[model samples]
Target: MRLIKTGFCSLVTAGSICGCTGPSAEKPASEKYNVLIFTVDDMRDYAGFLNGYAGKVYTPNMDRLAAQGVAFTNAHVTATVSCPSRNAFLTGLRPSTSGLYNNGQWWKAALPDIVTMPQYFKNNGYYSAGAGKVFHHTPGNNPPCSWDEFQDQVFDDPWYFQDWSPEKYWLDFGYRDPKVPMPDWKPLNGIPKIGNNDWGAIPGKEEKDYGDVQIVNFARDFLAKDHDKPFFLAMGTYRPHVPLHVPQKYFDMYPLDSIVLPVIKEDDLDDVPAEGKKLAMEGNNVFVKIKEYGKYKDALQAYLACITFADAQLGAVLDLLEKSKYADNTIVVFWSDHGWHHGTKQHWAKQTLWEECTRIPFIIKIPGAKYSDNICTRPVDMVNVFPTLVSLCGLPSMEGLDGHDMTPLLENPQAKWEYPAITEIKVGNVAVRTENWRYIHYFDGTEELYDKTTDPNDWYNLAGDEKYRDIIESHKKWIPASFAKPVPSKEKYYFDPGTYTYMDRKTGVMIDGRK
Candidate 1:
C-alpha cells in the first residue's frame, strides 16, 4: 500500500506514514517507527532492581529491561486510584487539572477539551490499537480520546488475573464473592454484587486463561504482522490489584509457608492522623472479606503471586519485542497505573498518599536513545508518557505540555534535574514528592512529611518537627494554590460489588462533606 497525503492534517510517504526512514540517506525522510506501550494496573514498584521487595521476589525480566533502559526510581502517578491515575497519565495532566479525582467522576468534567496522548498519535496517521484495561471502561461508554483501533479492551475483563488450586478467584472482592455460587451470567446492572457472591471462584491452574496473557498474545501476533506503515499498540494489563488471582503454577513458585508478609509493626497506624485513620477505616471493608476466607496467608501469597505472575506475563511481551524484526525501531514504555498497600499502616488498598500508593513503576526504552542502559533517579509522573513519546517520535511537540520531556534523562540517566512530583488522594490531601523528601498537606490543616533519605519506610512523620519545618515549608511552595472541589451532590457514584438477583447489589453511599 502506498502512503499518501490526504490533507494538511496528515502526510504519508510511499511506504511510511511519518516518512522518516533509517539513518541511511538512501531511505525516505517521512518514515515513522512503531510505538509499543504496556501499562499495568495497580502495580507498585516491586521490581528487584528497585529493591522494593529486595529479599522476597526477583523480577528477572524487569531487572533485565531496567539494565537496558532508564528505570525511574521516583515515578509517581498523579492520582492514587485507577480512573484518576489513568486519566492523568493518558491526558498528560494532573488529576486536579483533569478533574478526575475518583472512579465515579468523568474525564469530560475534568478536561473537557483535552486531546489525549493516543488521540494525537491517531491524528498523525498512526494505526493505534489497544487491548485489555486501556481506558477506565470498555469502548462506547468512556473510551479514551486516542487510538484509531481497539482490541480486547474488556473494561471489566479480568486481565492480569491469577490461576490457583482447583479454582480461580476473581480479581477483587468487587469482582466476586465466595459467600455465594457463581452466577450463570454476569449481572448487568449499574453496580456489582460481591456480597451476594455473584463472582464465583474457579480453579487457577489454567495459566493461559488470564487476561493479560491473552492481551500479550494479541500484541505478539500484531508485532509480527505485515504492515506498510508504523503502528501504535498499547496493551494494558490488570494485575497486582486485588482478589490476587493467578495460576497455581505461578503460586507454586513460592511455598505457602515461605510466602512472607510485610511486617505490620502492630503500631504502624498509631502515628497516622485522623484523616489517614478515616481512609484506612474505609478500606477495611475489603479486608473483612479476606478474613472470611481464612486465606490471610493465601491473600498475601496471592498478591506476591500476582506480582510474579504479572512479571512473567510481562516477559512474554518483552520476548516478542526482542525477537521482532522491528526491534531496533520499536520503542517500549512499560509502566504501572499506581501502587497498592497491603497491610501497610494497616491499610489494604491504594486510596492514600503513602509510598505504596503514590510511587509507581516507570520504564522506557526509546529506540536509538542516546545513552542506552541507564538508571534515572529523577522524579517523574505518569503524565510524562505523553510528551516523552511525542517528542521522541519527531512530531510537533504539544506547546507547554503539562509533562516535561524526559528525553534528556532517557539519554543521560545521571543528568541533573530537580523536578518534583505531585500525587493527589483528595483535594485537601495532596502529596508532593522530591529527591529527598515527601510532604503531604491535608485540607483540614493536618500534615505528614517523610524524609526518604532517612526514613524510607515512612515510619516517621516530620510535619510536626521543628527541625524539618523549613523543609516542609519549602515543599509547600510547590503546591498549587488550588484545592480539590468534588462534583456536587447531584451526581451518582457506583462501586458495584457484583450483580445479584431480585436485589440491586450494586449500591453506593454518598456524602456531602461540605461543612
Candidate 2:
C-alpha cells in the first residue's frame, strides 16, 4: 500500500512524516481523508437544500452542498426502495437485518457476510472509486469485493435513445410488446402508460448526453488525478430516476404552466391507516392516475425537469471538486437513495412507509468541519453513513454496526439524538422517524401516527390517539428485533459474473459471494 505521491511540499513538511498539514492546515491526526460520495437517484426533499418542494426547484449544486456542511434536517432511510434503500445504507444493516426488501432482493443473495460502504473503505487503505447508480444495477448486484475501481454500470446509460412508439412498444426494455394493450396506454390517470413511467423534453439531448454526464465525467477525471490512496470517490447520479428525460434547457427549467402540483387531499385517505389505506390505494396507484389524468401538472413538470437535470450534474461535480487536488482534503457526501413519492401520501414512487418515503437529502461536507452552515434537527440514520465514515476517517470500528456516531451530528448541530429514523418497507413493515414523530408499523398489525410538529404534510393521523399511546410505545422500540429470511432474487440467484459466486436456485451449489 505504499503509493505515496504527496505534494504542496509534502503537505507542509509532513510533521513526523504522517501528521502532515498544509492546505490550510488543521487536519493532521495522521492525515487520511478524501471520501466524496455524492449519490442521487430518485432524489426527494427537492433540494434548494431540502425545502422538499414548494415549487421552483433549481438546486444550485444542492444549494452549494447545503452551504458547505451539516444539513441533516432529520435525514432518514433504512430502506424505502432502490434496492432496499441501497442495501440499507451500503450494509450498515437493516432491511430487517438484510433480508433486502425488493428491487428484486439480492444484497449479495441476502448478506454474503457484509462489509460494503466501499468495502469498509477498501479495507482501510482507501482508493475505492465507483460511478453511476452505485449498486443494484442488477446482474449480480454490483459487489466485486466492493470496488478498488468499479465505474461501468453502462456508465448509467442514455447517451442516445429513442423508440417507444408502435403503440409505445411495452415501453421497451422490460420486454412486453405483444400487440400492446394489457394496461399499456394509460397516458395519465395515475400515469403508468408503461415503463420508466414516461416524461418528456428530450428533443436533442445535450448536457453531454447524460448518464449523469458519464457519471460526472468519471468524477471529473477522478478529481484530476495525482492521488495515491485516500480516495473512495463514488459519484452515482442517474437523474431523477426514470424517463423524466431532460435537456431542452432542463425542459426550459420547468414550465408547463409553471408547475407546482402536489397538494392532493381529496380527503387524503380520510384518516389513513388500513395499512395506510393499503399503501395509499394499493398497487400502482400512481397518485390515483395522477389525479385522474390532468397529468398533475404534466407529472409535475417532468419531475421538475429531472430535478434541474440532476442539478446540472451536481454543478458539474461540484465544479470538479472545487478545482481538484482533493480540495482541501475531501469528505463531501450529499445523499438520496430514498425519499421520493411525488404526490405525498397518495404516493407515486419509493415504496412508501412515508414522510414522503423516508425523508432523505442528507449532506455532509467535513473537510475541516468545525461546522459551517450546520442544521441537523436530530433524527439521523442512512445507517449513519457507516459509522460516520468510521468515526470521520480514523477507521477501525466495525463489529455488527447498526449505525451511530454521526460524529456527534457532525460536531453538534444540536446533537443529543436518541435514535428514531428506522424506515424499512416490507417484512413487518416499519417507519419510525422522530424529532416530532411519524411512527407507522403495518405488516398486518396496522398503525400510523404522524405529528411531525403539527403535521407537516403527514396530514394528521395520530394512530388511534389514545394520547398517542406513549408515542406509539416509543416508536415501537425501534422495530427490527428479528426478520431476515427473504433472499433468492436476482431471479433466484445464479450470479457468477466471473466468480463473484452465488448459484443456489435450489442448491445447484456455488454460493460464496464474498464478504
Candidate 3:
C-alpha cells in the first residue's frame, strides 16, 4: 500500500477551526482524489430523476447528481430497515454474514472488528470525517474509530428538546440538548400524533435550526479548509425519514388540494402470501389510522415536503463542493439506506420484501468519468457501494466482500452483468431482484414473484403458477440454503452509550466498542 503522509487538523471544534500544522504532500489530483458521501434517510424513488412518483417532485440536486454520474435505477438495499441496511452496506457484508437482522441488534457489539467504508479509507491514508445519520443514528453505533472526526445525529423534534424520559437515564446520553419546547405543531394536518409519526411546520423555527441543516454546515466548514491528504467526508441527512416536519414554506410547496397520493390498490395485498401480508401489517400501521382520519393526502404532502427539504440541503453541499478547490478531484457517492412505503402494499414503513420498500435511488459521480447521464438498470444493492468506492478511489482491494465491483458498469452503463440484487428483511426472508423479475421467499416457505417489465406496481403475484416454475427456480437458486442465526438485541445486553460497550446478559461477557 502507498503511504501519503500529510498534516492533521481538527475540524470538529470551533477553537481549532481547521488548523493544520505540517507540510503538504504534492501529489497529482488525478493520482489521489478526495471522497464525499452524502447519505439520506429513508429516501425512496421519489426524486424527480427516478420518475417513481406519479406526481411532480422537486429534487433538482438529486437530479443534477444523476446527470453528472451513473444512476443505478434498479439499486436495492441489503436489508430494508435502517439499522441493518446501513450496517451491511458500510461493512460490505450481508445480513447473513453479520447476523444483524434488526434495529435492536447493536452492530458495535455483534461485529466489533468489522471495518466500515469510511474506516477503510481512513486506514488507507485518508482523513475521514462524518456527520449526521451515517450509521443507525444511535449514539454508540458510530464508534470513534470509524472516522477521525464524527458527529452524532442531532434531532429537531419537539420531544428531542424536552426531558421526555427524565426517569430513564439510559435515554439521556447527551445526543440532544434539553431546551425550551417549540409551539405545539403536533397533528398539523388534523391527524392524531402517533408517536413521532407527526408532521408540521414549526412555529418559530428557521431552516438553520433543523438538525439536517446543521449537518450540512458541518460539511461546509470542513470543505472550506485546506487538507493535506485526500479526505473522505460523509454528510448524512435525516429527512424524508420521519416526523416529516420542516418549515411552512416546504409544506406550502405542496398544496393540500393539489397534493397527489400514491397509486395504491385496494386489493394490493390480496395476492400476497401470508408472511408478506403479516409484514405489511406490521410496524405502526399508520396507513390505516391516516385513512380512518381521512388525512392520507395530508400525510403524503408532509412526506414530499420533507423530501424537497432534504434535497435543498443536498443542493447546498453540492454547491459548496463545486466551488471548492477539490471540486475536480472529489468522488461523490449519494444513496439512501433503503426505500420506504407511503400507502402501497398497505404498509406505512419499510421491512417488507416488495419493490416499494426495496428499490432506491443510487448515484455515484467520479471525478472525470467517460460518460455523463449514465443510467445503469442492472440490479445492484448497497453492498456494492463499499467495494465500488474502494476500486474507484484506487484503494487496496478488500477481501470477503459479498458485493461485486461495479466499475465496469460505471464505464459502460449497458454492461453485461448477471448478478442479482439480494435484499433481506430478516434472516430467512429474502428478496432476489434481477433486471425484470423480483422473487421473494419467506421464512415459512411462502413466496412472491413479480415481473417488473409487465407489472411495475407488483400488483400480481405469479409464484404459484406452474408455467413460470422455471423463472421462479432460476431466481430461487440465488437464495442461500442456510443463514446465520441472529445476534442478541440491545435488550439482552446492558449497553452503556458513553463507553460504547455492551455486556451480554446470559454469558456475562463484555463486548468492547471499536474505539
Candidate 4:
C-alpha cells in the first residue's frame, strides 16, 4: 500500500483550512483512503428519503448523506439486537457463524481471534479509533485491541447534569427514589412503566451535555489532527434507542397532534408462526401497554424526537468532516445496528425475524466514486460492510469472511445481484430477504412468507400455500449448512465494568481483560 510522510502541516486559504505541505500534497493513486463509519442504534428506515414511514420523520442529515452517496434501500442486518448485529457488521459473519446470537453474548468470549473491521484496518497500517456505543454497551464489549485509541464508553443522560458522580446523576435524573425501586418504570400519567421507555424534552441543556455530543467532539478532534497514515474512525450514537429524551426543540419538531403512528392491523399477528409470535412478544409488550393506555401517539412523538436529535448530532459531525482537510480523501459509511418495531405485528422491539425488525438503514459515500444520489434496491446484509471497505481502501484481503465486496454495487447501483440478505435471530431461526420476498424459517421448522409487492406490511403469510412451495424451497437453500452452538454466557461469566474485565461467575477468574 502507498504510504505518506510522517509529518504534515496545514495551510489556510480563503476561509478554508487545507493540508498542502506534506505527504498529503504528493498523494499517490494507490494511497489508502480514510474510512469514517457512523453507527446509530435502533434506527430503521424512518429517514425522509427511505419513505418507509410515509415521509413523516424529519431526518435531513441522514437524507443528505443519501443524496451525496449510494443508499442501500433494501439493506438488512444479520441479527436484530445491538450486540449480535454489530458483531456481524464488524466481523463480516452471521450471528450463527460467530456464535453470538443475543445482546448478552460477548464477542471476545465466543471468537477471541476474530479480526474485526477496525482491527483489520489497524493491522494494515491504518490508525483506528472509536467513541460512544460502537460495540454493545455492556462491559468488555468495546474490545480494546480493536482500536488504537478508544475513548471510555460514555452513558451520559442529557436530562441529568446535576453532578459528576454516578449516584447523584442517577438520583437527580429520576432513576432513583426513596419510595420505590430505582429505574422502576411506574405508570406516569397512564403511561406504562418500562425501564428507559419513557420520553420527554429536556430544556436548557446544551448538546455537549449528552453522551452523543461528547462522541462527536472526540471524532471532530481526531479529524482536526494531521495524520501521516490513513485513519479509520467510528462514531456511534445512541438515541432514538430508548428513554427517548432530547432537547425540547426536537420534540417541538413533531407536534403531538401531528405525530403519525404506524398503522397496526387488529389481526396482524394471525398469520405469523408460533415462533414468530413468541419473538414478537419477547420484551415487556411495550406496544400493547402503550396502546392500552392510549399513549401510542405520545410514544411515537418521543421516538421521532430522539431520531431528530440523533440526526442533528450526525449533521454536526458531517459538517466538521466536510470542512476538514481529509474531506476529499475519506469514505463515509452510515448504518444502524438494527431496526426497531413500532406496533408492527404487535411487536415493540428487535430480536424478531420480520421486516420491521430486520431491515436497517445503510448508506456509503466513497469519494470520487462514480455513483451519487443513487439508490440500490438489491438485497444486502451488514456483513458486506467489512469486505466492501477493505476492497474500497485497497487493503489486503482477509480470509473466511461471509460478506462479498460491494464495490460492484457501489459502482453501479442497478447491478444484478443474486445473493439474498440473510438475518438470523437465534441459532436456528433465520430469514432470507430478496428484492421481492421475505421468507422466515424458525427453529422449530415453522415458516412465514410475505411478498413485498403484495404485502409491504408483511400482514400475510404464504408459507403454507401449495403454489408457493417451490419458492419456499428455493429460499431454504440459503440457510447455512451447519449451525454454531451459542457460546457460554450468563452462567459461566459476568462483566465488571469498573475493571473492564470479564470474570468467570463461578471461579471468579478473570477470563478476559480489556487490552
Q: Rate the local accuracy (lDDT) of all candidates.
A: 0.66, 0.71, 0.80, 0.77
Decide which is better by TM-score, 2 or 4. 4
Tens digits of lDDT, candidate 4, 175-259: 4544433433233334534545767754455766888888888978898998988999988888978778677788788887887
Off by over 4 Å in 3: 1-30, 158-183, 370-373, 505-509
C-alpha RMSD in Å of predicted model 4 compared with the true structure: 7.2
Summarize candidate 2's per-residue lDDT along 1-515 as a digit string, tens digits: 11122232232233312321223333444476778887888777878877878777888888878777778878887887788888788878887777778876677665676778898778778888888787766567786788878676653232212232344432533354554433332232234444557676544446676677888878877788887778787777777877676666776777787777778676777887676676665534655665676777877777777877777787888888888877777778888888677766666777777787778788887664445337778888798787677656656567787877666555556756688888887788888888988888887777888887877887778788797799899889888777888776666666766768887787786666554
Candidate that scores best on lDDT: 3
Candidate 2: where is the Cα deviation over 4 Å?
Answer: 1-33, 41-198, 218-220, 228-238, 241-243, 246-268, 272-334, 342-344, 347-355, 359-387, 395-418, 422-437, 440-462, 473-515
Model 2 RMSD to the real structure? Answer: 22.4
**Best of the two (1, 4) by TM-score:** 4
For each candidate, what TM-score against the reference?
0.79, 0.33, 0.89, 0.87
Q: Indicate the worst ten consecutive residues by lDDT in candidate 3.
A: 1-10
Ordered by TM-score, highest first, the candidates read: 3, 4, 1, 2
Q: Which ten residues in a row have the lowest lDDT in candidate 1?
A: 495-504
For model 3, residues 1-515, the per-residue Cα lDDT tens digits are 11121111111111111111112322333466688988898888898889988888899999999988778899998999999999998899999888989887888777777888888889888999999888887656777778898875687763543432443222322322245433455446565536457788877888899999998888788999999888989888889887788998988888888877888798988999888899999954578778888888888888889999999989999999999998888888999888888888889998988888898889988665546337889999989888776666656567888888776676567778879999998879999999999999999889999999999999999998999899999999989778888987777777776777788888888877756
lDDT of 1 at 373: 35
Judge candidate 1 at residue 201 and give its lDDT.
22
Pick the winner on lDDT between candidates 3 and 4.
3
- Quickly count the clashes in candidate 3: 0
CA lDDT, candidate 3, residue 99: 91
